[model samples]
Target: MVCVEEYAVRVLVTGGAGYIGSHVVRSLQGSGHTVAVLDDFSTGSRRRVGADVPVEDGSLLDTAFVEASLRRLSADAVVHIAAKKAVEESVADPLFYYRENVAGMQSVLEAMVSAGTRRLLFSSSAAVYGASATSPVTETSPTDPSSPYGWTKLMCEQMIRDVSLAHGLSWSALRYFNVAGAADPTLADRGESNLIPKVFRAISSGVRPQIYGDTYPTPDGSCLRDYIHVNDVADAHATVLEHMENADLCTVYNIGTGTGTSVFDVMTAVRLVTGVDFECDICPPRPGDPADVVADPAKIRAELGWASQYDLGSAVESAWKAWSDAPS
Candidate 1:
């Protein structure tokens, strides 16, 4: 196995200017690894990236551009974090999700092949496990994606596996649960569809937030999710990269807190953090919705020696602080 400790490692992050991607970039740099960025700036702001980092501004669908950037940087590893992640939006437009998430990943893989970069750390989701009956879904759980977004992530993982088998690529797909909070106020999640942002947006507009469903099988009769902190998610990328470089194997690990928090529970947390007793409307459940989706993080904790540091309240507190500070 090739070790990155023997020499300096340069990692190219595909969506380095985006929310999670930006934090991952900072984490990699802090770990003494040289980092560069490749993003089109469509959804990500250039301000999120450090001015010193060389950024290749282009779409991942453009294989030539990605390959050129990879070759230019001679990156030792590629952290593919670029993708459209809204589940509802994906169900509404499956074709767009396929093109952006699936096809875009293919372009990244093709570019890696051309550039002779063999290491990859994929940004995956628990959505790939769909509506499993398991309380805390394990890495070995049967994958049955419930949405187009989930399907795209599963397909990307499969592609990485195939590429590894055929081309000697070492990879790790960190299947993340609900990612929340911000390392910095400027890095706060600006996503309209994400739950925390949605709640903040509704409160800011003096409107009650909508709770999609209240008839699920869970204790709270709402969707249960493992909301992991973004900083911890960022640290997972760095740790997993180091693991892949030293071990040189293809593997999958769930990146989340083993605990689960329901949608209603999240609203309560928001109220406590923001000191606003906001009401919510229990509306019909959206399509492609799952009841419970938490992570069985034993694999990562035992293998990589990494664990989540923030609890649900801390996630809400940090997220509210950043959300409150963002410009209207």
Candidate 2:
């Protein structure tokens, strides 16, 4: 069994003010862990994390600031979540992605080494798997990234593995599929940049949402994705942190619901939940987008005892509630 309190882990969460990172910070705090947030406020907002948590306002690119924050927080483990995550934007500017995602990670690694903090949980993506013939991808699947964003994630995974092997740093890279939905109302905030939220925004504003590429080979010809709830993703992070002692020096796990939901299915769920009649305009497929990308979460389930509780409907309902209740 993993004993988190035995070590009394103090966690330093980079990008804790962002959408997914904020949820992770909330989950960590709920689990009785000391949490310190490091965010640049570039793509993240301090309001997302609220005022209770200490927010170290700085960029991960600044090695000095990151090292200083680690020393001041005296963090035992680091959950690195800061990265430029827009796939389309990355395709437009590959160099920016490399500098922010890859180089920023290198700085964080150096800071961790300096502070004697070894345990790390990295937020990877399904993009790393690219186009897979298999419906659901396993951790052992071949990585053939089709975009600059995907390539950056794969590069970071390799860097983490190398650092763990050479420097005795224990690491877990959670390769997440589509992280949709929102945290429960008690933890809701307005700053998120995912598909669900965008769709909600369109419906609320009396506009039809645009559907990218509805001609894919799926049940409804829309893109199919494994939509995991944000809370479930946060829970997985906490589970990994709690069970880090039992994990190997370098470990990778795919985090998802193990079921695929297409864009049409998600739209149907939204309409059912909100009673809103929204139209959609079919558009060409965005570059680097695969027809289907699901996850085989068996490895994570067996290794960390982590499983997703919310299904697609539940995820859509919760996300709708959040967007409807969002401050104007």
- For candidate 1, the clash count comes to 0
* Per-residue lDDT of 188 in model 2: 52
Assess the local accuracy of residue 284 in candidate 1 as a C-alpha lDDT between 0 and 100: 99
Q: What is the lDDT of residue 301 in candidate 1?
A: 91
Instruction: Please write out the lDDT profile of model 1 over residues 50-113, one tens digit for every residue.
Output: 9889999999999999999999999889999999999999999999999999999999999999
TM-score of each: 0.97, 0.95
Q: Which ten-residue region of model 1 has the weakest summed lDDT?
A: 1-10
For candidate 1, give the lDDT of residue 186: 78
Question: Per-residue CA lDDT of candidate 2, range 25-128, in tens?
Answer: 98888887889999998877666786778889989999989999999989889999999888888889999999999999999999999888989999999999
How far out, in Å, is residue 14 in model 2? 0.4
RMSD of 1: 2.0
